[model samples]
Target chain A: MSRKPVGNAPRREPIRTRWIWGVFAVLFVLLNPWYFPAGSSRLVGGVPLWAWVILAVCLALSVFLHFVCAVYWQTGDESDE
Target chain B: MNDSGVELAFAGASGITVLVAYGLLMLGVGVITWLANRGLHQSVDEYYLGGRGLGVMVLFFTFFATQYSGNTVVGYPPQAYRVGYAYLVSIPFFITIILAYLVFAPRLYTLGRRLSLVTPVDWIHHRFQSRALTTVAAILMLYALANYLLEQFVAIGQGVSGLTGGTIPYQVGVVFFIVIMVVYSWLGGMRSVAYTDTMQGIALLFGVIMLLVGSLMYFGTPGDAAAIMAANTPEKLAPPDGPGLLRWLSLLLLVGVGAAVYPHAVQRIFSARSEATLKRSFIRMAYMPFATAGVVFVVGIIGIAAFPGLDTAGSEQLVGRMASALANQSAIFYWAMVLLFGGVIAAIVSTADSVLLTFCSIVSHDLYGRFVNRDAAQSRQIMVGKLVGLVAVVVLVIIAWYPPATLYQIFVLKFELLIQVAPALMIGLYWTRMSRRATLAGMVIGAIFASALTLAGLRPLGLFNGLWGFLLNLAICVGGSLLLPPSMAEQNRARELTHV
Candidate 1:
């Protein structure tokens, strides 16, 4: 069985990945109702539009993240290493 | 809005029959799985991890069901209703589990492959040769997991009773699910549970979508909800202020860290066919909060306007209330509502099956296989585990019937105990200096302090959870390691192990 190399000095991933996480963090922060006036909304189809918009945004983000995960992330086989 | 007495009876019968049918089908899956893999029954690897051949989809849904079931559906909504905007942190907190996994996935996956570890306890045993520490961590995990399983069992009983208008008593509902869960889990082991989880996950997703559409058609939008809430109680719409902000941030940290270390979850990691599959599954999982948490949050917010002034118990029944209201509408809406209710039941059972399987695997693999019957054949160990699991379900079902307020207290204890293994998991992956004695000391100290603080109702000032326990747990893990010395042989072993 193979083991992780010692003193390999955790290799830093590209700054681009950090940027991606940063963007997601910020979006999540904003997507929550913390910035909006509470209990405040104009009606659209008998529901609060802002809340629906937030839900839509959240759904969109989830789908987007799923796509990215499916496409971009790769887990290399341990046997090869 | 009181319909004919006959209508009520029909609805009750329909609900109970549908739930019973679902349970029977789940049991059938378990039996079939057992027959298919009967030859492999003697191997610990095959029974616990399905020969470690679980694919991405099966692996993904299993993790999905484990994470989102009882708490996500039942526990979270009331919190959203109560706290309003602040509790939205529950969504991101879930997402954070995936983010947290990225930190150690690369190394842990490699190490897990190298060691052929079955449970997280095995990883500890491999890293730290101290049997005492290993035993303590195992006991703590078993206790926490049992409590967690009991919580799900209680939810099954409450959910059935509430959904069926109390026609079926809580005791019967608990027994029905518990028996079915045990049989299926005993037969197929992980494979049976994973297959059922995939089905349950799909059903749950469908149910949530249907409910979302139904709510939109009935109640209008968030704006409408806001108008109603504003007219009745404006406070429900306002962003959280003062302690609320602090509470939200605390929730994000507490749940994110606590949930990632769940034993069932760790076991799933070992079941993955490859590192890529695990990583891919997590990446997709990072996004699930939107469907599960976001949808549920919206439902709770809508409840603020749709059904105002419900006290705590009534509020807890928010989903059921909305479904009943929808069912009373047109024929199409009525059938759809019933399906959604059935789907919820399916989700709950799916979670119960997975938990029961994990509970059995740990007992069979760790406690019984390691201690009581070290020389027992693989088939014998599996049988012992299954028997113990059946006994556990019966006892837990009894507890579920009455259920103490301390359920939540016991529930929270799971995370604290599970997190005790984190130092070993994370540190042992990289640091060779971590002595077996020190690691053992930290786990023991962590478990005691966490349980003590929890029992004493000790919270860190304004925070909602027992972070104090964690603080001490971490301190002991890090501090004890520094104070103790690693043996020369152990050091050499660790170095050799990591020398890839």
Candidate 2:
């Protein structure tokens, strides 16, 4: 069994997605009531509009995570050394 | 007998029957795992980490169990009932755990696999070989985990007695399940916990979905809930004010990072069979909040329409009321509720067992093995951990029986202290310049600041006390590291240690 993870794996192009985490932080703030103050009074399909907006953003975020898990291939890469 | 008393009496009998069957099933899992891994008990790695061979499904469910405690089923709805739509923060906070994992888990998993790490403390010891640092980290984990275990004990007693209408007394319920948990854990260790957690996770998932359907059928939908709240409690339907928004954001950040760093959760990252298994598990976990917390949020929202005039304390009874009403509706719903409460008690036990196991590992492997007896046999270490875990559970059960009035105070205390470790764990992984002394200083200052602020009832600017301490913790770690740089060789070693 190989004890060294990055040592044995064949090298590939490093997937640079640190900036995507920044995007997630920004999106977190946007989904909150701070960004859509008017959503409190408004109703979307009998749910609060802010709640709907949060759900939409969460759906988008889940899709983004799915994409990241698929494509973020920096695991076991020793190129940093 | 009164009408409600008659109904509870009927439900009480059903609750006893279901709990007995559930207990048997869990014990069966214990026996099966023990039989499967009979000769391997002598090895700490096999006992504590399932030989690091969990596939994607088991890994995912074990992860699920750690993230969604009985609190998600029992505690969160009441919070939603109190805050209305604002409690939607629970969903995002759960998702943020996965986001926080994104920051560290990939690299950490790679490193842990290569090093054959067994506990979170082991990782810290590897990064900075200070005996003081390791012990402090272990003690902090034990404190938080003990608090966590106590909370589960209290919840287990209440859940059993409440669901059974005192058919099983609170003290009896706590002792009964704690005994079962200790035995199974003693027999099979992490394999038993992981197997039972998968069962409990599935049971809770089914129960939660049934709860949503049953609540909607008996009580009405969210639209009806919205209309009723508009008529009766319009303020609940309205948007949160500026202060409310700030508090929400603080909670989002606090629980996000806080829950992810939980000792058990972090250790699981080291237990995955392969990197692919770990990655797939996280992907599925990212979407679980919708089914788990999101469903419970809707249940709480529907409670506004179904049963009105509930203050926060009274709202805690909302799930019981809805489930009781469902039981009275038909035999099918009655059995369904019995299963739901059964699943709930199981969920509590599953969480408690995980906490207990992690607590033991830290004590035996980190404190005793490293500091007290460096040359102890691996089997001896496992035995010591089991005994210590049993004693701790007994002590915690006593506290649960005669719980302090400030039991709720302890519920918040663990997160505050646990999050203090985050600066060291998160920053140390990526930034090699992080000084060991600086990390220690940051933990000391942050823990003191958070605990003192909590004791004095001073949450400055309405932020959660943990957040306030975290900012200070982060500041110290950053500033202290820069001021007292490590020697050239030390810096090189630190960089080499962190490279993944």
Candidate 3:
């Protein structure tokens, strides 16, 4: 109870969080296997090249998000000051 | 399935060495814990909860290990392999955990500090003033956690068998890590788990990076992978459509919410050293999916072209088979392959240690101290918790040895049960009107519904998971709270506590 609030104390906005999550949800819908054409692909070395690309993109995106989170999203705790 | 003589011997020797090393480390951890907690600071708060002093890095990694280990590495690849692009949902779903926390964690963190809340049950006990509700929530949390620990045990055995090419028997692998984990967890409590998680997390990251590099070198680029997939099966590259899209979205919702509520994870929030540390760590963790999920997904996708026509079981073995193939190709590849194998084992141990610690804390803090021996000294509570943890590990190892059914199926069941606690943790954070009775009723009904549907092989319409049970759970929690008025005393307490 002794803790004082910090920062601009961004107005509690559940809606904004919900919308951002919605965007990710939409992206998830766009990314799955149902849209892809079914059948076998010829092997390169040993794998399908497109699949590898998707994996790379995912890896890149995940790393990018972690950096963003580390740098931006975090607000210091109230107890720190 | 050919068991070459030389390969078998090499695998056996490596496997034994890894298990022995793991055992010694765990025993060492236990001894450290005993020494640290032996005298003046032997309270439950110090031992079970690490004196509530975890910094952001330790807190984040502890949470990360609990969520990502075992299944993130072992089970997820096969899913990615089977569903192809649809499994891309895994990364976003994981990122959603931080997003979900943003919804209420700040408030909860503040509240936790003020109340000295040791567990999620403490929050419930304070908010609702209902013993029945707190008890039910505690039992449900215990069941979900034990089931989760059991799955880790099962994974340890399978991971060891696969990594070693069956050179280590399943029973030996299960017992080996279980013994190690129990010893260390009993030693330093959360401190030991967190310290070791830092080590485990680093190994998993290094191993996965090495695997990705090795895969690209051995196979080729995505362009190459794409050309191969296009010729063999073009559908693997296409984006999801219709029901596939629906299922993907459902997966995102189910796992995002489900994973965030795990008892172990909630406990980590309590362990944070300062609010700043928690925030910094989360910001860092918000991006971990790239290293953890991103790497596993790449490995799975590459498997598409590298090894084709694999059945479900065969697909699950993709990482191991791919590693084995590469190692056999050259001397350099062989050593790199062994490191990757070691990394995978490290990931499993890291996960097991964290789960075991959380499991012990729950028993010590919630069950025994709260119910059985209410006035027991702090040291006594720690003793009961550690003993319960040791017993639980033994039971789980027995189950792992026999393995009543499939590993993945049991793994899925763990999430179904754990996700039931979401309403109480996520919703109760801000909403003062959420009555304890209502929360309990919703959780119980949801748990029963989820368990029944899973056992009956029922999927609500065409949804891929039993989290449909959660829908009912949420509805009951919301509806019951609104309908049943909170006692005046309860309302006053909530207002006083949550006031900003």
Q: Model 3, stretches more than 4 Å misplaced?
A: A1-81, B1-10, B29-41, B405-412
Give the alpha carbon lDDT tens digit for every residue of B301-383 in model 2.
98888888876667777788788888788887777777888889999999988899899999989998889999999999998
* Per-chain TM-score of candidate 2, chain B: 0.97
User: Could you give the TM-score of chain B for each candidate, in order?
Assistant: 0.93, 0.97, 0.93
Clashes of each: 17, 0, 39
- Which stretches of model 1 miss by more than 4 angstroms? A1-75, A78-81, B1-10, B404-412, B498-500
DockQ each candidate and list the results: 0.30, 0.37, 0.27
True contacts kept of each: 0.39, 0.38, 0.32
Candidate number achieving the greatest lDDT relative to the actual structure? 2
lDDT of every model, 2 decimals: 0.72, 0.83, 0.70
lDDT of 3 by residue, A5-67 (tens): 476564343323555456545544443434345442434444544344545544454454444
Supply candidate 2's per-residue lDDT for B279: 79
Give every prediction's interface RMSD: 4.5, 5.3, 5.1
Candidate 2 accuracy as TM-score: 0.95
Output the better candidate (1/2) by DockQ: 2
